[model samples]
Target: MNDKLDLKSTDITSLNIEKIAALFPNCVTETAEGKRIDFDLLKQELSTEIVEGNKERYRLEWPGKREAIVTANLPTTKTLRPVREDSVDFDTTENLYIEGDNLEVLKILQESYLGKIKMIYIDPPYNTGKDFVYKDNFAKAGNEELLESGQKDEYNQKLVVNPETSGRYHSDWLSMMYPRLKLARNLLTEDGVIFISIDDNEVHNLRKICDEIFGEGNFVANIVWQKKYGPANDAQGMSDTHEHIILYAKNISFWNPILLKRDEKQLAAYKNPDNDPRGVWRASDLSVRTFSENCYFPITGPNGQIHWPPESTSWRISETKFNELLNDNRITFGVAGTARPMQKKFLTEVKDGITPQTWWHREFAADTKIARYEMKDLIPENVFDTPKPSLLIKRCIEISSREGLILDFFSGSATTAHAVMQLNAEDGGNRKYIMVQVPELTTEKSQANKVGYKNICEIGKERIRRAAQKIKESLNQDSQDGKGLNQDSQDLFNLGNQENQANPGSDNVQANPGSNIDLGFRVYRLDSSNMQEVYYKPQEYNQATLDLFADNVKPDRTAEDLLTQIMLDWGLPLSLKIERKTIAGKEVFSVAGDSLYACFDHELDEAFAKEIAKEKPLRIVFRDNGFKDDTAKENVRQLLKQLSPQTEMRVV
Candidate 1:
């Protein structure tokens, strides 16, 4: 067997073309300028064609440290991640649903979406004395003996979760989340923000973690959402009805979320009871910021009596502005001129402020029941438990993201996807999503298993499909009733079409006469990580030396093509050349500008091997099972060093 190439021995920077090709006089020749060149010396060169064979792949080099450190072994599973492709999807969307272990999915996205995400909302396992599963190394579990005894399998490796009841509850959760958080940090764009939802279980810990990950300087407000309008009925002591959402940003110095728009309900509060030609208005304060010594003087009302300021809260404007309002009758006092002066605030003048107070569930309720209902309606009953409300998701998305990309790795029930569709329907906006999910085998005792689902990801896709169907149905219903919701139905598909008609199939197909909504989300399933290639089986016929070698006729394929493949596998640049020639009734190929040479004629001679190796390619790889003579192989190795001392050779 040939040893692996000693990569350490090949110094790319030290290579010099002129000096190395000097030894192989027959195989190499010099140009007029004394530049070394390989002659057409017939030898088996690297195969360019992707033949039917497994390829040995290489990975990026790992940095080495001198000291060895002991670490816990953890179990891990190959997690699938998502990628988004640019395409038209309805008018606009902003929600996403990812269905995978967020840790792995986040890592997979680090390269393509680093520093790009705006908001990240996750409801992780509360770790309330139950086993929270995450992929980890198994060796730390004393499974080395089992592995060595062949009691364990490789592909079906199992990862164990540390239950929260364990003494290291906090430690375990932190360890599991650290790397994932590190990766997620890279996905946040500079001005991006993140919102994490959590219960008391680890709210403090989560805050500290965010402070570390997003930098304490960027820590935004901690919003306390009234997840439940009523208190928990079965509370041991106190009923908990609220949850905290910790907000942070990639760069607080530049990050600012869009203020929530006031709904029509709020707008309906103002009325123009006394039409003053300024439209509808609300009453505001009329007092000055401070009781100005000069302004403390009595202001005569329409009755010409002294009007005193209020006891505490003062006005935002100066007395000058107040008098101006009084002159324009913008300031209103008592019904019969007996009340204190009040400024009139026109509805048109006030900017919609950020939603007030930390408590939000009052405005946006978290009816887990509603989410469950949505899931059951879309998928098999009880396939999933807690799903964040679409309203909650839509709110978060509206505040943080524009018409940009959204990602969800823990896409349970696909609520985020539904929210994106619903929000887009509400207000036209285009936002894309990439969802990643793992096909973790379903537990036999789980309801989803009874329904024949393999895992959560399966349910996730079904939910998206069903949601899209519902959205289309709802939009179509609206369109038939002559509602604006029909705008989203622009992509309706009809049944009839000529098989060969090519106007970009969907573009030419007319929408169903009554249809109203377009199915917007595209689904993709992630497959095993592998670079696919095609190959052919080598011919079975065996011949010591055929006329193919004797006539110096080359294979239809060129050596340059084969060399390119070798470079791909070797992780070398593809821009290398080859010189070909016939040698002793055999064809040989020498890498252009390099000492590398290859031949697989089985009838190779020792003298010919010496001549080829004389011009040392930095490294030479060959088929180990191909050489016919053991003595000749040994002689070739000995002569390789003699002819090209610096060349490292290998056989595979």
Candidate 2:
């Protein structure tokens, strides 16, 4: 049996390169020091034609381009620290709210969420010169660099301003975003898509990098969203009234965006003028710009007037098709029956909804003003400066994802979370979200501080709480008015129940049968690994120091910390339900309801292990130092194997 502990976290980028090497051995070559990619060989293997070095290519480059690549490939010795007190319904919620530097968070999430995210919508720093862009120090370790920077407040996050006057202004911002985006792409499913909110300041640069990362062919659309209603009369040149939302897919061939629901105004155009049995209908043009010899013939109107195709235009269909449509009463003329011929399009014959347009209007999508008002309504005393309206995010969610996982790493003010809840309530979807944000401190003189919000994360968590309460209240009101949970809601509620039964001890709070909304999220903060550095680098420790180190785990680390680290190592979702149960008076954590059972209590005996084995957990873990002696440890392992032969066991 393997007795030594494995405290190292997974190196995600290296694993990716290893996967590539597995597929193409020739493309992977080793240097004198370590394994590295043979790019020339890789390019030759991938293409029929080859291009030599120093040749002009269609690509984007910056001052720190190479350094940015190095930053992304470097693995970090960090872990997510669960904070139960900072969370709402930490044990039961499917959602996640991570308070940390998003870059590190993305790296930590690589294992558990790889290729699982359905959609990602990030509103990162617009690079408008005033936004704080993270500065990663590649020379030093992440924890060491963070501590030395003195940027960690109570939240342990560092934020630095990237002003336009700086020599490497654009390079700094690009470097900050490059690695994060690269990591985020790894978490997207094959059919997944990402939407990034940006302004004119860096939209061009953002698109170039996204093309490089997600591939140019996967470019979906650059939606122009009208964010302002009235113009800024006092402008430098032009009044900026819109922002761009750049979209890209993991694989364009596998992605198909959902259609948006048609508004009442669009539906109003269709009318049952003739009381047609097919239903409401609208008149469509019967001519097109293309010239077709078969469709050049003229047609006689109801009043015996000759109707020819407009100048340089031809009939939309062939003569045979037109005759068939006319025979079926699908063609129409004006009310007087003397106007030009037209085609009647019945509402039922068309799609259930309208195709999403590239241009989003302010009315339906909601404007910045409305977004401000929403924040005001939630926390009347204070409001975020530029929160995206929930409706805008709702539209993105509806288009990009249905009932799958959504993520927003730059989830300022938690508008994305609020939008997810609101949309779930509206469509009865069980879509979950993961929100990550640095606890950027609020200015002391700002309204947020005056209202008791110390950081951006505080505002975000509160927003989710208030948003959920509002949704529940609305649902209750609807129920009292004779409109109870819809069929979709009931179905979702049943699904939740089934999951709950499958994982018996996972959920502490069960969902009410009448309500099918999940409005809570677990909270996890970024921190150093649970194990002490000396555990991994034992050569740095002297014999005397090693002898004194009975336990590899840090003195301040708790059982929960060890459990979360194990979860990460096992590639388990951080939001998985965890339950604390007692076995032989010793507290055992039942993760995801027997998926994993662990006990960190010291001086553990064989009887406790056997009692836990009786449950037949899929996996079990114990602290190495928890046992009284070597004999106790061997006895517990033998008993567990005899009782639960299938259970995989490990130790911290």
Candidate 3:
């Protein structure tokens, strides 16, 4: 077998040689006599091997380490595709709408976004008798099947649903979820938090898994939301309408959960109509927890008759506290001289302490009626089913992430995204959202699928579009006075779209195109090609010459952009070096960084990638796309792979 495989190494290191072999196992297939032949067959195999090999190497190598200093005038532009009437691109806006298996989508996200997310909220399958389990190829490693699908095997199923009867019910759920959760955790910021909505079927199991991922110490609370208003009328006796939303923080110390505000609406319940100096307050009986002998003692009243306290009841506060309250004029006696002594609960003096309870009643959260109404209002004739109320999600966002990025991996009907948009609209705060949903083939069995929708993700995208339009229309209508139209015409996604004039009017706000106007989100699909690869044309011109040619094109500036710099500086092709790489330890594009020894596309396991990033190059270039694992993506070499691994890494 060794003789048949006539493999030899040159200047190429053992690592690169091994990488080449892994890409093509049949590089040295021979005849029975061990005679070499079939140059055509060998060339075809080698060419195919090189194609995959270069992509992997390009993804792992850094451009900063290259010997040359010439610019790489490689193409840099995204490929926009039409999806069911909508055009999507990477620069559309900050919000993202991916249409594919969420697991794969999460894997792709690890490259450009790791440790950058602020919050994540997901509503996974409950796995009840009717819940479908996801089939993940846990036995296989990496994304080999994903990369080779369709082109090689049309019959191959990338993803499938396992029935509830499978013996590996819990195992299957955990297996399918483990990798995704690990990846999701990487996307969170140090001060980030995640909320998972589940039911009795796997709440305990979910908690255990989350504890393993987010750490047990970060567990926040298990909030129970009232899903319905009335009790069950069925024969079994009881109806369950509530579900649980479990919360966990990336780091508890960094995250600050907000206290529900004591707004005017709630404060209106208290009254000061009688002009009492103590301010607005209500009345309550001052009670004790213990059968106190001192509290039970009889007291002399204005009527001359001595009144003794009830034998069974005692004051709520300690004797010392009660005496202090009496001394401070806080304790109130009966309106008339004959009433029992009570205490004035002044609204102004008390702190509005919000204790998030396990049972979420209708008053605290949006009721089912409101949830249904919200769906009907946004969607005509109710296109989707069981959409969560904006009010409910708004409360969650306000509590968990008052000001940060919010993610919804299971963005059913884009409820969480809509909630984030609505929150931003109300407070005028810039909060971004990234949504992921599976484009599972839809059928008539489902209401949304029946009405022209092909998958759950389609409904999600449409919902966001229609919802945004409605939000915009409402904002236009609610403007103060007649100047509402011009007061706030800017979009929710586009920030700083407005321009500033040299001399501004007292109330004049500059209007900038594509600025204040919500440019709508810049959307990029997980499978979409990187801008450089799509635009690069290597066959027509040599990249080395392209960099030098720029001088003739324009000599006034005597400077070049990253693309040109990469071509001249590194013998590595402009299309390759100015790519994505693992610098120091994090995933970044090299054209954007200033470091020597550029490992343009550095794999998470590559020590060379970290070493080069740690040594900071004048500039590093990397393939716009690379890295398949989420956990490994966060190891950024800010300066050193250990302490400062963050280097400038740009996508061509």
Candidate 4:
């Protein structure tokens, strides 16, 4: 296979254009430059009615709107390099923490994670005139720019700050968000949902863009979360104490958000005062504001006084149904039975939990002060400026997702990762998380820099480490308190035990309940592809140049690097469990328990090939130069065909 084009991501715009051309051949035309679409012809082909050009239409527009579309369509030549030293559990964890520009990271993830993510939660810049926005240079090649940025060094890329003085202040923020949201929408499953946190700064604009991207029909709700407890005393005018968490579903009809668990106060409303056989029950108002002639009836109280529906009001149910309900003791009155009759909703008959409401009070979800305290408790130094409380994110996870992949491209402070771990601990879920953050550098004299955090990504990674330890400790304590570890925990601990046996003296290692939880994540850093440029453009090289570039892979790349690239090419998840074993004195990497097997050794003989073939992996890969000669390569292929006819074999 050609390595150059095959290594890059799919060109989304070209595919879209091909789809359009297939439908309307007449509208597809070639220009002096390249293939071009005739808008007038396409419009005519789409509809028989005349389309007016000057007519006013309802649509969101900005200075860089067209450019934003181009950005999302462009394919990147970037790849994620595994950082084993930075990872918590390099070979076993199903969670991932990606450090890079989220836009490039999203492009790299498109093939492997498309339509697989169940929920996405992002807290992007609020565009408060001081926030930084990514400056996407569509003209430049992605690989060249990424290389020049020095991926391994301290983050020094200049982030564009959209100050109020800039001519395209609002436009810049919108432009930055437009393409990212479009890409994010593609990753969501059919029943998936996305929650975006934003303040009043650009809430209206955000809603318009989301309606266009996710469809107006899929718009779920605009939840008003009390982010702060009380009004700011130093406010110039009215204090802004709340933020909006806009939610949208991939397919609204298919999505059924789980109900929120009932808190003590909500459960307290139900009482078994009368010793009813149906357990505890709560009273509900029986009157309705709408004038329903059929429901405009009354009932006689136990005190022998007749009670009629209040003025301009009617019973919630018809008189016939009310009679049946009263006969079944589904109606309630005051303690003395003198007040108006009400409907009785038995706790046992109702759902186990309560439906989520649009307004989230600070008491249920934590406030800003509580969030700060949480950060302070974990890390003595406050590195993040506005770290969200874990409870707030926990609620979002509980409602939208259960046991599927969750992504957060704009994962500031890694709050989503922390919340995912906490929720998994509570409910024994196998939910996994993918957190992507741009390594935006901290201020020179800021607390983060002084405390040894060079960039935001450092703070985020550290937070996950601390959060995992804390969760494991808490779970272990619970186990000691006689609440034995759940099944999920036990399974995780067994896996951890197995891993610990393989690799000894790893940090943060614990026993029993602590080991059962997957509090570890694989870390990957975004960088240029492992293949050298000469591999893609071999025709430009002469005999001497070709000799120097004989091996298409870069000199610095390792066996693990090629394995990761193969995973991406094959659309395998980066978090898949990996194992390395020595067969016939040759090291072989096994991915996902025989789903894929690869040997990147420099030299291979017949014995090693036969040993690998005997295992019958679904897919196998080898280095082109690994074979001793042409005879060796043919022998290995013949052996594999005989031993495992179903296995797909490839060489790099």
By lDDT, who's the top model here? Answer: 2
lDDT by residue for model 2 (119-193), tens: 999999878788888878768745787786557666666677777756466677888899999999999999999
Candidate 4 structure quality by residue, lDDT tens digits, 134-226: 777666544555464334244424256677756466777888899999999999999999999999989999999999999999999999998
Off by over 4 Å in 2: 1-54, 141-152, 482-515
lDDT rank order: 2, 4, 3, 1
Candidate 1, which segments miss by more than 4 Å at Cα? 1-100, 138-161, 286-300, 303-307, 334-337, 352-357, 482-528, 531-652
Cα TM-score of candidate 3: 0.60
The Cα error of candidate 1 at residue 610, in Å, is 38
The candidate maximizing TM-score is 2
lDDT winner between 2 and 4, please give it: 2
**TM-score rank order:** 2, 4, 3, 1
Residue 412 displacement in candidate 2 (angstroms): 0.6
Residue 651 displacement (Å), model 3: 9.5
Cα displacement (Å) at residue 593, model 1: 36
lDDT for predicted candidate 1 compared with the true structure: 0.55
- lDDT per residue as tens, model 1, 1-652: 9888776766442244434444444433323232233433312123455434334353211111001011111213222222234212412222334444455445445544666665666655565665444544434444664354332432232334556434345555555555566666777778777777778887887777667667889998888876654566888898887778788888899877777765555666677777769898877766655655555545677777776666544555667877787788788875577667777778778876445345675334344544554566567478876777676677778788766666565565667776666665555555556665545566779998898886766777677777777666655665476444423322121111122121111111122434323345433333222211111212432355332343222234333333333443444321234456665555666654564666545645477767676556787654443355677777777787888878777653
